[model samples]
Structures are given as structure tokens and as C-alpha cells.
Target chain A: MIRRFIRLLLLAALVAAGFAFWMTRAVPLDEDALAGVEGDVENGQRVFTAAGCASCHAAPDTKGDDKLVLAGGQKFPSNFGTFIAPNISPDPTEGIGDWTAAEFASAVMQGVSPEGQHYYPAFPYGAYTKMKKQDLADLWAYMQTLPASDTASQPHDVGFPFNIRRALGGWKLLFMDDNWVLKNAPSEQVTRGRYLVEALAHCGECHTPRNMLGGMDTSRWLAGAPNPSGKGRIPGIAPGAFKWTEGEITYYLETGFTPDFDSVGGHMVAVVENMAELTEGDRQAIAAYLKSVPEQPSE
Target chain B: MKNIVTATVIAGVLAGSAALAQNDGSAQVKARQGQMRVIALNLGVLGGMAQGKIDYDAEAAQNAADSLAGVAMIHQPTLWIEGTSNADREGTKALPAIWEDNADFMTKWDAFVTAANDMQSAAGTGKDALGPAMGGLGDACKACHEKYQQSDD
Candidate 1:
């Protein structure tokens, strides 16, 4: 009986050791061609808007020009706990000023921090992982021009098991590949739309359903889920989630009306506010991408 | 003796407003809901122009904004006479919080009036000015919905 107990303890130890090893692995960006390119500040600003980085990182309830500060105090609530947005300001001590371009690219695309730690997916790096390297460089250049804020990033208020950043490695292992969410594209427009929706726009961060572990279920991508806000449904915009045609979807992005003539309501109202600002082609690309996504039966 | 009389009068007024429910808010529910739909229509026009989704037609925007202002001005005090929640009615997405906190609900309505008035003036100026004004008005509508309306989720 004592020998059996000892063997059980050893097995448990081995399992724990394996998980630790898996969780600490660093995944860096592998694009070799991006190394020598210089980033453009003008295009970087465009990337900033497309990525919607300010919405999460800016101070909560900030309006108008204040969004440019990027001091990072927005709080996002989740089943695990609350996540406070970290400072992405240009301040040397509190922000990313000291980060190398490669570090920024890796953090933004590969979800690896400067210290080689995994950033929380709340940063939406899963979608960013598919971002083009040039865009990343431009975004980095744009960040350089923003005013450096003195505000510090706050610690996340998560539960014990969820709080362990290392554990995120396992979640990353399951969901962190950099391939396009839609592998086969029918057209260049569809491909552009995919890049916008999957990478820069990061629409799936809210729209897609998650598995038990909180990694997005790409199979049901954009099929809609309960509002992360915990109030209403986030309405699936994926194929078959609603019966909207490409034109209707485009019209809605432009005018905020659905087929039933329901005006934009809920959290989507804010999203439309952003999409409305994008160029007409950008909005059309998003519409095209939404139409092309493989259909899933209503969840 | 004089002080006590004034205090009693004040308390009486407060109690009267608190007990102001004269109906179950049934007959007026559809009218009120229809008012909400019209408001959304006006908002769509202004919002489309403001977001640059549609070309800025100053006249069209002004018309939409004016319609919004007109709708916001019509206060059916009797229509809000308590008990008009989704629980009691079939079409509403309104929560009982609207009736329970009538004073707060009216405050939100007042905000809508103020925002609509601002948008009414701003819409005539063209896109750049109207955009922020429309955003302010959208927030006003959203604030009420967040507190008073039931979400579809």
C-alpha cells in the first residue's frame, strides 16, 4: 500500500513538471524579411485606428483627443476576474519606449512580452498575430509620436489559478497559431477583409464563442456569443448567424440598420461608431469577409 | 408651528409624485414604443451622415436632427404612468427600473432632450461638427437603454 502511494506521488510530480515546461516556452515572430524595413509614421496612424488599440488602452470614459494619451486604465471584466489595461505609453519607465522594434512586433503579433512572458489574450494578440510586419512597424512608429504618459500599468485582479501567467501558455498552445483564421480565400477583397476582421479589427475577441478554457472556438468564429459585458447577446455576424447579405452588412456598417430595420443597439453601437470612421473600402472589405466566413448553425 | 406646516407640505408633494401611477401603462405602451422607433430612424440618418457613411447632405441631416428634436420634445407624461415593463407588456424591451426609478428615468429623458437640441443645431453646420454631436446624442440614448431596457442576449 505504501509503495502504491509513493508511485502515485511521483506520477503527479512528473505531470506538473511537464505542464511547467510547456507553459514557459517563448514563441517569437519568425518573419525574416521584416528586419531591414523602415516604418512610416503616417501609415502607422492608420494601423492604430484599424487595430482599435486606443479603445482598450486609453483611460476609461476618455473622450475625443484624450484617447491619444494611451495611459491604460480601462478595466475589462471576465469570468476569471478583472483585467486592468496596462500602460502602453511612451514613458521610458512605465511604457514601451525602451522596447526594441522586434520586441514590439513580437509582443503585438506573437503575444510574447519583452521579457518573453505571454501577454493576456485580452490584448487581442491572437488576431494581431496575423498582422503584416509592415503594419506592425508603422504602428510602432506611430506609437513613438504619441505623448508619453506617466501613468503606470495596474496589476490584473484575477483568481489564483487564472492569475498564473504561465498557465496561459497552455491556452496559447491550444489557440496561438498565426495562420489566417480563414485559410482559403476566394478573392483578394475577401483576403483583405480577412486581414482586417481577423487581425487589425480583432472582431473575434468579442464575437466568437469560447471553449471551457476561454480560448476562442474558431470553428464557430463570429457566430456570436453572450456579450462579454454580461448583459446581451453579441449577435453572430458570421455566415448563417444572421441572414444578412454582403450588401446588407455593408449598409449596416455604413448606416447601422439591420434587415429587420433595427437600429444599432448595445455594445455594437460603439463598434459601428468606429467602423463608420473607416474608409468605405475598409468597411466593404469587412462586409465581404463576414459573408465569406464558413457558416455555422445557430448556436 | 409655521416650520412644521412647510415641512408637511414638502413631504406631501414628494409622496404625491412617488405615488403618481394612475394606470398600468398598457394602452400607452405601443405609442411610446413607436416613439422610440421613430427616434431610431432619425438617429440613423444623422448617424449615417455624421459617421461619413453617407455624404454629408446638410439639409437632410438638419431634417433628421429636427425630427429627432421634435420627437424628443413630445413628453407623454401619462404614457409613462407606471407598470410598462416587458414583464407586463409584450413589445417593450424596457425594464421595470424605468417605472421604479421614474425620477432617474426622467433625468435620462431630459439628457436626451438636451443632446437632441445640440444635434439639431450641429447638424446644420456640416459633418465635422455634427459627428461629435451625434456621438454625444448616441451616448444619451445608450445610457437610458443600459439602465432601462432589456438586452437581447
Candidate 2:
């Protein structure tokens, strides 16, 4: 009876390992999805600033966070564990130098990293998926302009179940959408705002609520989510909490003040400082777009 | 009775002179002047650090702490004063609330000074004691910010 018990335990361990392996398998990239776009690297740099990419990804020392300029070592803490952001710099040995443009697009739009692995939503690919193909190409081109830094990426310090990358496939199946841009075209301002908010800045990654499985709850777009950094709450910017006029929002973006007369603080302080440096038109577009979003609280 | 009358006259003269000195407007002028007051304090502290006057010198550290306290006390008020005036230049995100909620703002300003003084007192004891004092100062910042500041995100 003791011998039989030991065998049963061994079999269960094998099954669990197999299950873990299966969950992290990389999803296939659709090569044709990002075809046919006239990309401009210069324009992409402007879009990148509008999106606020450098706010989180770039090292504090570097002036900006270039997508291909990954100088890794930023730690993202979540419910499961700490996820170390990887080096996406164009280094042949340690970064994405070998990735094809389609593979890069797939990772950004589909949440699938190179090597067929599904990336955890910690990368904010969910919002990035809404980027237009031309925009993605431009971002990619701009990334290529960055000087390569060969920083070996750190491994994520996740707990047991979450450590399994294969499980992310199921998570993606439930939450991931491969489309790189929103289907409906609203006003040009709204479209521009959506592109900046959803694809570029990935604002919802901090502001939107998450589901039990740890994916973003799409139904409640920008209605404030708990900060992944485990510090203070990342407040919601929906109409309910902040019924800002377009001018007020624009002023805040340009100068970091709310209509109520409070200056932005914490992580957002850096964001506003960066926004302050952007073109006035881009700032206005973001403000107009944010105002156009439907205001609803998180469920 | 004559001695008492003489003493009263002397006291009256002293009181008048004190009032005249207080009304000289120097303090108000210092408070209303540009960002120089805060900038001066910052420079003094930096100079102290550079000269090794702050390393382990109890008296120097105490003086530095006192200077910081004085500046901290007037910091928010100056912001309110300057922010309300034409000095409210562009690139300054000082919210209008600084002037609108003056009472609560002053209270927070007072708390920050108290915390900063405590830090300086601790720092005078030793460099190692500075951390806890800094923590108190940080708490003061957070307390006021949570209520009054907006998220930049």
C-alpha cells in the first residue's frame, strides 16, 4: 500500500509539470496582419512621446524609454509575484535584434513574445494591441534608431502557478485580442486619443480594473485600477471621478494641474513632466480624446 | 509714585520701538520676494554639505536644520503668495487651491515644518539618525499630497 501511494504521488507530480509546460507555449504569429503601411520613423517618435512609452520602460537615467532601447531592470510587482521587465533592446545576444517585424508586431498586437510564448499582461500588450499597423511600423522604425545596449534580461520572480508561461495561453485565450487598432472610427481627435491612450501609452494598464485571472477587464476601459507597483492607488480618470473639460484636461496635460487645482503627483508627476515637453497639438489631441471617452465606473 | 511713573514711561518707549521694528516690512518683503528665500536655504544646505560642515558637526547641523525649518514654514505660504500674483508664470502647475483652501494649506505647511525641524534635530545627533527624520518629512509630503495633489498619469 505504501509503494502504491508513492507511485501515485510521482504520477501527480508529472501531470502537474506537463500542465505547466503546456500553458506557456508560444502562440503563432500572423505575418499578414501588419502588412501595407507607409511608416515614418520621425512621426513615430512623436507618437511614442504622446503614448508616454518612456514613463515606465526607460531607465530613470536615460532621457527616454525607447522600445528597442530596452536597458532592463524595472521590476513590476503584481498579485502573483514580481515580473522583471525584459531587455527589448536590439542586442543580438540578449535582446530582440533577431525578431522579424511581423514577430515584433505580433508581440505588441497579440501579446505573444518571440519564441511563441504568450507574454503576461504585465507588458501592457492588451492596450498595445489597439495600435494601427502603420503606427506599429513607425514605432518599430524609431526603435531601430536607438543605440543597442546588451543588457541580459532578468527572469521574473513569480510564484508557482503564475511561473508557468504556458498558462498565459489560457489567459490570453480569455483576454487577449489580436487586432492592432480599434474597429470603429470615431472623430479624428478621439481616434488619436484612443491610439495614444490604448496603444501607445497603454494608460489602461494602470487605470483599468483587472479580472480574477489577472487580465484587464475591457468592459470598464479607463475606470481606475489598483497600481501594480503595490504602492498607492492609481486613481480612475473616467468622467465620474474627473469630469474635466477638454481645455482643463489639455491644461493638465500641458501643465499637470487638475480643474480642481491639484498638481499631479507620484508616478504621474514624471508623466506630466514628459507631456510638458511634447508638441501643443499632440497635448490637445490627447485631451480631446480623453474627454470623448465614455464615463463609467468599474464593476 | 514718581519711580513707578518713570518706569511706565520707559516701558511705553520700548514697546513703541518694538512695534516700529516689527512693522518695518522686511519679513513680509522676504516672504513675498521671488523664489530666492527657498533657493537661498537650499544653497546654504548644499554649501554646508560640500564644506563637510554637515557631516558630523552638531552645531552646524543644528543651524542647517533651523534654516530648513524656517524655509519649510514659509514654503507653502510663498507658493500661495507667488501663485496668486503675476509671478504665476507658465510651467508652474501650482493649483488655484493653494489660495482657495488657504487654511488647510497653512496647516499642512506648519506640519511639514514641524517634521522638518524634528529631522534637523535628529540629524544634529548623528548622520545615521537622519533617515527616520526624513521618513517623517516624507509622511508630511504624502499626507498633504493625498488630499491636495492630482495624479500626473
Candidate 3:
């Protein structure tokens, strides 16, 4: 009777292990999605500007023209651990210079690394997954044009359980969806705005609150989160809480001035710099989307 | 009875000094904000004219620029006393980084002073000139705030 019971226990454990292995497998990008789109370098610059890539990838407090160098040593402290931004410069030895377009797409859109490992959602691939393939191609092209740095990418300072990249596949399965959070687009402008906000700009990555698993709390989209630094909360920009007119929002994006003339502060300074590079129409579209998003109180 | 009275008096003195220390930090924060408000008001005048939301009155623009330059020149470190940052005191957006990185903060202040002086000269020129000068001034204000302030907006 004891021998029979031990055999049954071993069978159950084997089934459980198989399930865990399958669930943690890395899922690569769809090949069909990468077909036929050519990288347009000029358009790629627009995509890069909109995405605000340098905001994190650049060395912290990098100023002036040096912001273009993607050396990437900024440390983002989270409940999980401090995720260090990696060197993405076009240095063959240290950066993504050796990566193929398919590899890049998998990393950016699918959060799968070249070695078929799951990347932490700290990279914001969850939002980027919704981006148009054309924009991804363009952004890839633009990134290639930037100056290379030999700075090696740093490993993230995460500990047990969270440090296991395979575990992130389960998190991605739970939270990563290509669906647009906003369903109805009232107009072409709003639709464009939605694309920029939801996919390209990835405004929700910072503005939206998250659950214990670090998955974005979609119901509270654009409702703000606690500042990762723990100094204060990042304010909500949802319709109910933001209280800024579309015009005011656009102007602020353009000039970084509040209606009362207070200047932009903190990390938003880099964001405004990127926003200012975009066209007035793009800024207007962003403002329109902010106005249309579901209302939520600030965190 | 005498010993009891002595203990009560010492306790009262300690409490009084603690309250005074808290008040001092708050007062410094208030004064620092008052100065910043002055800077913002002048920037508003120039910003409005640059946007053409307010009429481009050369005299008003120049006056605002002059006020900005004047405030920028004032070496008011007393207004930013140690332990008066947002982390230490309530109701102020000033970050402790201001104290932590005082040299960087001072360099930003110097840059603001330079930009303000430039704005003063540019404001007297036509609206076209005023627009570009305001851009420089705005950048200086932005650079400092990005490092030393913890504003939500």
C-alpha cells in the first residue's frame, strides 16, 4: 500500500513540474508581423522621440546633446529590485549592435531576449507590444544611427523568485495583452492620440497604478502610481483628476509651463524635452487622449 | 516638591525649543516659496507675450525681465536653510537633493542668473527676440527644478 501511494505522489509531482516548465517558456514575436515593413530612418526619429527612450537609457542627469548617447546606467528602484537600464548603444561587443531585427522585435514587443529568456516587465514591453510594427521598425532604424558606446550592460539587482526571468513569463501571460485599453475612438485625432499614448509614448507605464505582481492595474489607467523613489506620488492625469484644458495640456507639453507659470520638475523635464521635439499636432493628439481617458482619482 | 518643579520646567523648555525649531523650518520654506513665486510671476509675463496670449507690450516685458534678473541675482541661501527641504518640512516642493548636491544646485542658480540677465537685454528688443530669450530662461528654470524640486505637476 505504501509503495503504491509513493508512485502516485511521484506522478503528481512530475505533472506539476511539466506544467511549470511549459508555463515559463519564452514566446517569441510573430514572424508574419515582421514581414514586408522597411525601416524608415526619418520616421524612426519621430518614433524615438515619441517613445522617450533616452529618459531611462541615458546616464542619469545627462544634459545637452549628450542625452543622445544610450550608455544606460540609470537604476530604477522597485519593490521587486533595482532594475538597471542596459547599454543599448550600437557597440557590437556591449550593446544590441549585433542583434537582428527579429531579435530586437522579440525583446521590445514580446519581452523575450535573444537567448529565448523572458525579460522583466520593467522594460515596459507590455505597452510597447501594442505599438504598430512600422513604428517599431522605424525606431530600430533610428537607434542604429545613434553613436555607439562601449559601456557594458549591467545586470538587474533582483533577488530570489523575482530574479528568475522564467517566472516573468507567467506574469506576462497574466498581464501582457495587445488590446487597446480605450475601446471607442471618437475621431481620427483621438485614434492617433490613442496610438501615441497607449503604444508609443507608453504614458501608462508611469501614470497607471500596479498590483503586487507589478502588472498595471488597467482599471485605474492614467490614475498615477507611487513615485518609485518613494518621495511622493506621481499625479493622475485622468479626466476627473487632471483638470487641465486640452489647450493647456498641449501648451504645457510644448513649453513645460503650468497655467500658473510653474515650470516642469523632476523626471518630467526629460519628457517635456521629448514632447517638445514632436509636432504641435502630436502634442494636441496627446492632450486629446488625456482628456478622453476614463476618469480616476489621483493615487 | 522642588525637584518635581525643576523636572517640569526642563521638560517645558525642551518642548518649546522643538516647536521653535519646527517653526523655523516652515518659515524658511515659506520665504523660499515667496521668492520662487516672484520668479514665476515674471516668467508668466514673458511667457504670455511669447505665446501671443498676452499682447507684446515691450515695456511690460522688459519690466518683467528686469524683475526676473533682479530676483535671480539675490544670493538668498538663508531662504534655503538646512532641514527646510520638503523631506524635512511640509508644504514645500524643494527636495533634499538641494542640500545633498549644493554645488550642482548653485551651478543651476548661476545658470538661471545668466539666463535672466540675457532675458533682460532681449526683452527690450522686439517680440521675436523676447521669444528665444524666454526659451533660454525657461530651460534654466527647468534644469534646476528637475534636480531640486519634487513637484507633481
Maximum-DockQ candidate: 3
Query: Ranking under TM-score, best-scoring first?
Result: 3, 1, 2
Instruction: Assess each model's interface with DockQ, reporting 2 decimals per model.
Output: 0.20, 0.07, 0.68
Whole-model lDDT for model 3 versus the true structure?
0.88
Q: Quantify all predictions' global Cα lDDT against the true fold.
A: 0.80, 0.65, 0.88
Rank the models by lDDT, top first. Answer: 3, 1, 2
Per prediction, fnat is 0.20, 0.11, 0.74
- Poorest lDDT segment (10 consecutive residues) of candidate 3 chain A: A27-36
Query: What lDDT tens digits, residue by residue, belong to model 1 across residues A191-276?
Result: 98998899998999898898778889888888888766565577788777578877778767755556444556644555665677
Candidate 2 residues B16-81, lDDT tens each? 988975655344444544433452454345333433444556676567667667666554543355
Per-residue CA lDDT of model 2 for A1-299, tens digit only, reads 99999999999999998886666466655786657766689977776666666555665334333433666777777898988777777677787778888998888777787677778778877777777788888987877777677878888898898877777877876777755334564788777666676677777777878887887776676788777655346777777676777776766665544543333565665566567667777677777766666677544
Q: Which numbered prediction scores highest in TM-score against the true structure?
A: 3
Better of 1 and 2 by TM-score: 1
C-alpha RMSD in Å of predicted model 2 compared with the true structure: 17.0
Q: Candidate 1 — which residues are off by over 4 angstroms?
A: A1-23, A29-34, A255-262, B1-32, B41-67, B76-153
Clashing pairs in 1: A232-B153, A233-B153
